[model samples]
Target: MEPVNDIAQLVVNGLMSGAILAVPAIAFSLIFAVLQVSNFSVAAHIALGAYAAYVVNTVLGLPIVAAVAIAFVAAGVVGVASDHLALKPLRRHGPITVAIASMALNLVLENMLRFGFGNTVQALNIPVYRDWVLGGLHIAPQQFYNFLIAAAVMVALFCLLAFTSIGKAMRAVADNPVLADIKGIDPEFISRLAVFIGMGLAGIGGVLIALDAAIEPTVGFRVILPIFAAAVLGGLGNVAGAVAGALLVGVAEELSLLVLPVAYRSAIGFFAIIIALLFFPRGILGKR
Candidate 1:
């Protein structure tokens, strides 16, 4: 009974952690799918989202939902601006150039955040901190909410990709931008839209993470490694794959606690990334 309970608890915690990771993982996958660039600025966007939500929720005394919404919109705008101002110009320069530019953008955003918000850790002041216990499992309210929200967002994204015209256009562009342009699909518009949605998801993820733990300027950099591992393990350009990869990594990280020191938990993700790259370069779900 004790072993069963412990296993169940670990699984629960893994799922919750995976839920939180799914958003950023999906964001990374989306940008990679369309642009073929890692968009290192994603980390900065996430940190900015958390700080934006913090200001709205703490300084302005707004509700958590409102703060999250503001963060989403703000991040989306930033993403669009990034594409237009930074990545768009490097379109003819190749993927490596674009990636380098994105890294520079990330540095700028990180410094801006540090300058504006300082280096101190901050947390969201949401009113719900209670946990829900079912049988032998304990789940925090925010954890449960995060799972539901992540699931819903994934579903919505699938629907958008499956049923909407814009989604088809995006897919077409992803497969072959030159061909998509020949077919009258605007690659530039699709790219901007993809960035907007991707960063919006990142924003939501940032807010949820801040709700669960304290956040600082460096929080973005800290989580980017795991998020990248999940993306790579799942498949760089596959959104569904990213979610599955995130779950696997999350579970692996949590279960590692049973045998490894807590400080080494992050090592699990790095190990997974290394192994996956060696054996399955395309990832678990990536196309061969």
Candidate 2:
């Protein structure tokens, strides 16, 4: 009975963590699906988003909602800028060139963050720390909130993609940019919009994480690999797959704690990625 309880707790923890991870994973997958470019700078965007929220909360003394809004808008703008100033111009240079450019941008953003915010860790002061206990299981308020918000956002994204004109256009462009353009869809505009949405989602994730845990200049770097693992495991560019992969990775990481040290928990993501690639090269849900 005790062991079963432990397993349940682990599962709960995994679900909570996975909910937080799904946001960025979905965002990363969205960008890749549309642009076919692995934007490594996404991690930087996450950090920037959190920092933007911090500024709004600390410097401006705004409410949490305002901070989150600022973060979302700021990150979305950065995403669009990256696409226009760097990615769009380098389109003809090939994926490798674009990827390298993104890496450079990521470095630049990270350094800028470090210079401006310093290397100290920061936390958001959201006044919600109560937890609910159910069936001998403990659940933090933030954890529940994170799950709810993530789930809501994912559903909203699905609706946007499934039932809206812009969503159809985005999907059309993703399926075949040249064909979409020929059909009167502006591929460039769609690409920018995709990046904007992706970064906006990342910003929301960053803010949630900041509220739940301490954030630092390197916070984005720390989670980027796990998010990538989730994206790859779900089959890159598959939005629904990314969420599924994030949950799996989160559960796997939590379960690994039974045998592995806390410090090495993050290695679980890398292991998952490697194993997935070896057995399922196209990802569990990735279409070849």
| Backbone clashes under 3 angstroms, per model | 0, 0
Instruction: Return the top candidate by lDDT.
Output: 2
77-192 in candidate 2: lDDT tens per residue? 98898778877798699888998898888888889899999999887767777679999999998789878988988999999999999999999988888999999999878988
Give every collision pair in model 2: none
TM-score of candidate 2 relative to the true fold: 0.95
The stretch of ten residues in a row with the least summed lDDT in candidate 2 is 122-131
Clashing pairs in 1: none
lDDT of 1 by residue, 56-105 (tens): 99999999889878988888899899778988899689888988898899
Query: lDDT of candidate 2?
Result: 0.89
How much is the lDDT of residue 73 in candidate 2? Answer: 90
Global lDDT scores for all candidate models: 0.87, 0.89
User: Candidate 2: where is the Cα deviation over 4 Å?
Assistant: none
